[model samples]
Target: MKTLYTLGLALVLTPLPGLVQAQASAEPEIASYSIDTTLKISTDRKTRGVSDTHGEPGLELTVEAAHESGLIAQLQLGSVSRVNYPEGNNLNAMLALGWRGGNPEGWHYGLGAAREWFPGARVDEAPAGFDASFTPTGWVNTRFHTSYLVAELGWSYLTARYLYVVSRDFRGANTATVCGNYLLVKLPSGDLGPALDCYGSAMQHSRGTQLLDLDLSYPLNGQTKLVAHLGWQRVRNFRGLDTMDYRLGLEHQRWGLVWGAELAGASVRNRDLFIAIDTDGTMRQMEKPKLILTVAKKF
Candidate 1:
């Protein structure tokens, strides 16, 4: 009986090392977490040419985590020198779930849902008895929120994405659907090793907004690159409101640190109407020919 018991114990111990190795090998290897910070200095802080900071600099810090299962969560904190609110800062957080597979040389698709929260971010309200023919008094403080369901499909140097807004603030100006497509072409080495990126987007809401853009990047050296961008935008609802914008910039990356400087400007038709009204019924024109500097670190 003693000899039989010893044989059973030996049988169990012999496979334990192999079992541990198999378990370890089965763990997913792609899970990661990262934190990054960016300091942005611009003459005007805005989204798509709508002024948010009223020509003030902005700083942002972001922390993100991702799992091998394609779940991601991120928190972004931003501060501006000026905002409609007295606090001069805001918080944005997002949680997303997505799956990405396949190599760049093959067709790939990613579908995800992201819930974005802008805690305490103010919404711009139309003036009392505002008319659609005329612009609102200006953007004022109100509660604004949004969510998105997004999908991307890509193969090689071309990609396309569709973004649908599931929720938004009471303001009717927000876009409900956005579709974007981009193509990248790498120029031959003799052509200064420049790369060209062409993009187009259509945003749908009460009306359609379309944008076409071209970006070029040329390597200046091992660590520095020169970039230029030009874009044209049109709004279907607002006639004579088409605009052209451009940017010239240079970026350098070294030791996981990135820095950039850009000069950007936009020419807008009926620019005054594009300005947002403040809670105090103030309308400030968008600043043009702005200089921006940015520094970022990744970990």
Candidate 2:
């Protein structure tokens, strides 16, 4: 009887070691991150001077390099047009590279930059928050990120206008100044453009504005999380402009499947100079702030 009992105990303990080894081999021991989609919208109000206002949809397709590694990147496509800039729209692209490490490797940190190009605008001088430059738009961006903090800096440049290749507006306005427009660029002669300047333009033709973005994230469980971000931007132009932007998100996850909802906002207005690009025809503006939802899966 004693010999039989000893044999049974040996068999059970031997199987336990094999089970532990299999479990360790089944888990990933490298670095990686996930790719997500971002949808954002914004709106304006009555403080600066506007009779009417509206909103629109903007979409962004984002990517991640590795899961265990903190390195990442992103791409985006958006449309914005209203009064004097209607037929006008924009395409913006950006990238980010960073590191992830620390206690439990939950904290991520790194730095990188981005460049954006904007074309097809009805107006020129009066600059919006996200639009690149007028007639051949581009900017150089710098970014810093950590577990709970983010910082960014940008410097923009103007490329030669390739449109029509006949207009002189492109010829007069092709310099890289943080304040004031290129040259022929002019703002809408109404409350819309003026009010925007007061609230957010930093004056007009703002070149390299300063931006600081802060974020905090909380994990509810292994597959669910929440995040909130607050941002501030300042630009130098004919006058100084300031902006406040906020975003909150809730996300659910289940291995390769993810979905989320977000609310974002911005307060912007202006009162400054004007630069018109395709005038005498039709002009429009593209700006909005609406709720957004999205879902995605990985293979």
Candidate with maximal TM-score: 1
User: Model 2 RMSD to the real structure?
Assistant: 14.4
TM-score for all models, in order of appearance: 0.55, 0.46
Could you give the C-alpha RMSD of every candidate to the true structure, in order shown? Answer: 14.3, 14.4
User: Candidate 2: where are CA atoms >4 Å away?
Assistant: 1-54, 66-90, 97-108, 119-204, 238-241, 254-257, 269-289
Instruction: Tell me the tens digit of each residue's lDDT in model 2 across 135-225.
Output: 3233322111111122332222111111111222221121222223322234334334433233342223333444566665677788888
lDDT (C-alpha) at residue 95 in model 2? 44
lDDT of 2 at 194: 31
Worst 10 residues of 2 by lDDT: 156-165
TM-score between model 2 and native? 0.46
Error of 1 at 121 (Å): 4.0
**Against the true structure, candidate 1 has what lDDT?**
0.49
